[model samples]
Target: MQAVHTAATAPAPRFALRSSELPIGVVAEQLGLTLRAIRHYEEMGLIACGRGPKNVRTLGQSARARLAAIADLKALGLPISEIADLLGPDGACPDRLKARLRAQLEALDARRSAIAGYLSGL
Candidate 1:
């Protein structure tokens, strides 16, 4: 006799999310970031999020780490465009970044030297 299958006997579909992966809402709350900002980052290609069950956005470990780095860069006053270029598709800082960093460092040193000179003269 053929075996009978019923709804009760059918296996429930499951979303195969790894333990390290989190939905966007959970990630935003955990990271102390607003959902809008997280979504903006997603749209900017700064962090890649995978589609979870029911099309929910899920961020894996690397994407979460990237978001943390993005937050740090934002805190350091780096613009989104520059951050995007710095963390581009290759996921490595390009050679031009070294030049940009040097330029920024030189400007900062110049400002610091000027401030010190003013303080010394006063």
Candidate 2:
């Protein structure tokens, strides 16, 4: 069955995949992600790919969204385990996600302060 593209399901203009059930390589190319990285995410249970004709791995719309979300979380310095939890079946509670982001911000602030202190001494 073909997935419908709603505003939410539609890929971002910045990084769009052409179709549902695209080959893993196509998805990687479209998203500017490496094949190994996609495979790793699959191995980590973060995304699941289906086997298309001739047993080729294919990523559907949902998997693409998960991959994008995973990249966003990774960019924000979230550990994979934490990301997994956030993206789990519960579908990312806003309060929990906010708390995690707040923690990350606090950690960054602390690091920045320490760096400034060291610079002052130098």
- TM-score per prediction, in order, is 0.71, 0.69
1-122: candidate 2 lDDT, tens digit per residue: 99899998888665444466788888898878899999999998889988766667789888888888888888888888888777765334467777888988999999999999999999
Clashes of each: 0, 0
Candidate 2 TM-score versus the reference: 0.69
Every candidate's CA RMSD:
4.8, 10.6
Worst 10 residues of 2 by lDDT: 12-21
Off by over 4 Å in 1: 1-13, 29-32, 53-55
Off by over 4 Å in 2: 1-18, 90-93
**TM-score result, candidate 1:** 0.71
Best by TM-score: 1
Model 1 residue-pair collision total: 0
Ten-residue stretch with the least lDDT total in model 1:
88-97
